[model samples]
Target chain A: MNSTDQNAPLLEVRNLSKHFGAVRALNDFSMAVRPGEVVALAGDNGAGKTTLIKAISGVFQPTGGEILLGGQPVAFATPQEAREKGIETIYQDLALADNLSIGANIFLGREPMRKAFGFLPVLDRKAMAEAARETMKRLDFHVSRMNAPVSNFSGGQRQAVAIGRAVYWDAQILIMDEPTAALGVPEQRKVISLIHQLKAQGRGVIFISHNLQDIFAVSDRIVVLRRGVQAGERKISETNHDEVVKLMVGG
Target chain B: MTSTSPAQPAEKHVAPQADHGDPATSLIGRIAEGRAWLFLAGLIICFEIWSRVAFGATFVLNPFNLQSIAIFAVAPLLLATGQTFVIISGGIDLSLGFIMGLAAVIAAHATNMAGAAIPLPLAMLAGILAAVIVAGVPGVINGLLISRLRVPPFIGTLGMFGVARGVAFLLAGGTTVPVRNSWFALLGNGRFYGVPYLVLIAAVFVIVMHYLLSQTRFGQHNYAIGANVQAARRAGIDIRGHILRLYVLSAMCAGLGGALYAARFTAGAAQAGEPLLLDSVAAVVIGGASLFGGSGTILGTVAGALVIAVIQYGLVFVNVEPFWQFIAVGVVIIISVLIDQAQRRFSGGRQDE
Candidate 1:
């Protein structure tokens, strides 16, 4: 793994808080992801992992706190704004349009256009197909039917396509929610390695997962949350599954 | 939930092989998607055989029969064109029928009023433009109800259906609005070189619709939203705005259909599109578009519409009861949906939990 000590943080959330009526969904949560590093967020159900990621990804306005990108404080009005600022959140089972091709999925909202007959604008299908081909290839993933709908692809392949989308748009920070949760063993392994490739490319990743093995396998640091608060943070090399589980369900 | 295994990178470099599996299955898949064309071809052959056996004449080769069928298809086809977009976006516009009727009434009134002081051709154009624009009003309401207010599509459009129908009838004073413009009548009834002007207009309109659905970003996004709206929203699509535009576009299509109807019969009836709602939706379904959304083509709907026209005209040509048209269309729609279901099961079998 490349040493991220010399690199500055790509994304930082300081004292973030979110509340829905009387319920504190997330409170006083702070984290930083540096270039070429993967930070795994570990928590049990209702421990505010989703809340934190949603707040960071612009799905929800934080009740209080600040998010900084490249040393500049930023507030995103919507997820689209976050994406434009290079923050992409790939929600589990909610990322790919099953009936669309990989290229179409990659260029969903922002489609490439070229003039036909020098006036009429049309979708640049050739450009989309070419980008899909190159993006998947760049991720070390291959699917033969580049134009086929993604419903034909397995779970892991779909995950790769989602990652390919992030890569194609040059997203600097990727927050993946349970990326491998729906995949088989081999497919899960494939997704882990895709994360490895992202880390190698100097992109920051916040991998939220319940699986300790997946978190430990690709992440450099792990942050465990309990009851909407940070329970513990540890280096992967220093912590084991038992200790992380203890942090998740504190006495 | 608690399975722990060391992650290995051995399988990382290996590409997942395409698992479409077997030539026969793929052949079935292809057949399923293009079944609308097959149905149209099969219907033609059947009609041709029936014509030869019953009247010793060829049904397909008769220019009069072909022309009549094309004319018969225009109104329904136009409505289906709009329905195709709505259905592909995972919604149905039930108000399109009354919307067409409303447009017809508006077109008749507008044309007659304009014809009193203007050139006939200009008056006809003004009528059509008015009908289409007025038709978009209900569409905007429908869009607001469905997209902004979060009303279910079926209920929302159905509500518009009643409202449009009542308004159209009220505007016409419960009678058909007779058009007085000679040019409007000529456009509806006249033809060039053995082809009806109505057919030509519809053909041009259909071609444009095909382009809009197949070649534009709006079309692609329609498919995306239908297939998985959450994914589309997350991908940064403006769902509410798109829905608003979509409904407006649909209403405008229906409006055009109504104006054409007013031209064809030289009168705009409040019920001009009352019977066509079912036919339009059937054409879309028969064309291979799923009502559940996301997988249809305009070309398919064309074939579907032609199939209905042929069924209606052919049944009449063969001396079948007029009521048989309803039964026959219903059967074909069911069969198309069955084919769609079988195809989905065949291909979507890989979507495992």
Candidate 2:
């Protein structure tokens, strides 16, 4: 890919709109995420940040408009399809299976399988564990053991594993929904560093958060959504938090 | 900022270091999470003791009697496996017993209609088909009502319980339908490699179910749905279709179990499995499956079924009245739930601390 191609936005939504009965969850919500940039999505609760993320991640098909990946229009019928197109989403709850081990949760839905020699095929646990360890290491995740069940991990470590799973799957566009909503200050810093690392790897990241301080620290650009419509998009260096908040409130 | 960073690192290190004082702490966590399996072991030990005291030996250890113990355990084992899937998906199929009974009656009627005229394979196929259809219809209905209409699975399956049992009685004229096919008798009673075919079938089901629950995408979705349906949906899982399939799969297993029962008995009574409803649930609960859903294993269900079987067999070995077996099963079920609650409370405390 040329510099233009490399710098080009990986995902672009144009005039997207979605209506849930009498309410419009999104309206003309257009945004673009360039490669190697962390775009912060900041809005008040119910300001359609989630709705926009869902639409882009293919959880809900937009009632109107086009989504472009690499400047070509693409439609995703399912989240799996979106995932196949290299869009990985880590939701607020992290979607970890508590009963399963950290490795299992990371490799859930897609597992490594060795060829069947006779009547039985085997799960390649060694390969999976090795890959899980590598992925965790790359993300700078320090945990007691990869064999331990995810329930044993603290909130921040769990979040790291969730992010690692997405990154390991080669997600080109990472959408994180409130990555540090409930974490303490140190944990928040850990996640922020991870986000920076994700952006540094030349992948586009859409960071949805209510914390403007964290947003300013990490985001190159900030997009504001208000009642299902795009309020504005501003370079993080140019706009103050009050202006962003005002735009988010539709003032 | 420097003091805070160092202090925070020290604090984080302290908590994990404290946990490291005993390498057994993590092992304890693992064991606690697997407390259901532990409880199962305890049950087995208790039964072993009772059997030795009553019969002057461990009855299950006797090679000649092992087949009988297995034969008696297969039906409930199959039923428990099916129930585990249903329950793990955050639903209960109360219709399981009735559906099994209905399947048995259907299979019997089919076998009788064939009555030496049809080829043995055809007759068996006919019986299996009849049972599958009988059990599958209600499953589809349950799935539709629960998935599309958003009815509570409890109400839908309970309603199915009544409907299926009533249909079985109507078809059998409120009595046991005699098995006229000789092959059906052989199928139920025959042995392969000294193991009863019915037992083999149940074992196969356990293996298949274990693979499905542990290795497949459907299994992951089932756990996800049970853990949190909304989250599963948000992850792009087809919650409705998956839930429908789960109910159908469960019912199909019940249907097969019923067929096995009819083959074994050479007759299909309307109330054949009526008493097994609670027993089946008891088996799964005893195996360590949560009633609230999201966690369980086929092995657990198998162990649970065997536990029930051992309790029943142990009672006979000890010359205790059969009626007391029911009370024992009831007591075991209560204790299993209490143990699960205690485990949860312990884990909850750990999480809080």
Highest-DockQ candidate: 1
Considering only chain A, what is the TM-score of each predicted structure?
0.95, 0.94
Q: In order of the candidates, what TM-score does chain B achieve?
A: 0.95, 0.89
lDDT of each residue in B16-60, candidate 2, tens digit only: 211122455656556655655676577667767877776578765
The global C-alpha lDDT for each of the candidates, from Candidate 1 onward, is 0.91, 0.80
State in Å the error of residue B352, model 2.
7.0
Task: Give the range of the ten consecutive residues with the poorest summed lDDT in model 2 chain A.
Answer: A1-10
Query: Highest TM-score, which number?
Result: 1
In model 2, the Cα lDDT at residue A57 comes to 85
Off by over 4 Å in 1: A1-6, B1-15, B19-23, B351-353
> For residues A112-172, could you state the per-residue lDDT of candidate 1 as single tens digits?
9999999999999989999999999888887777788888888888899999999999998
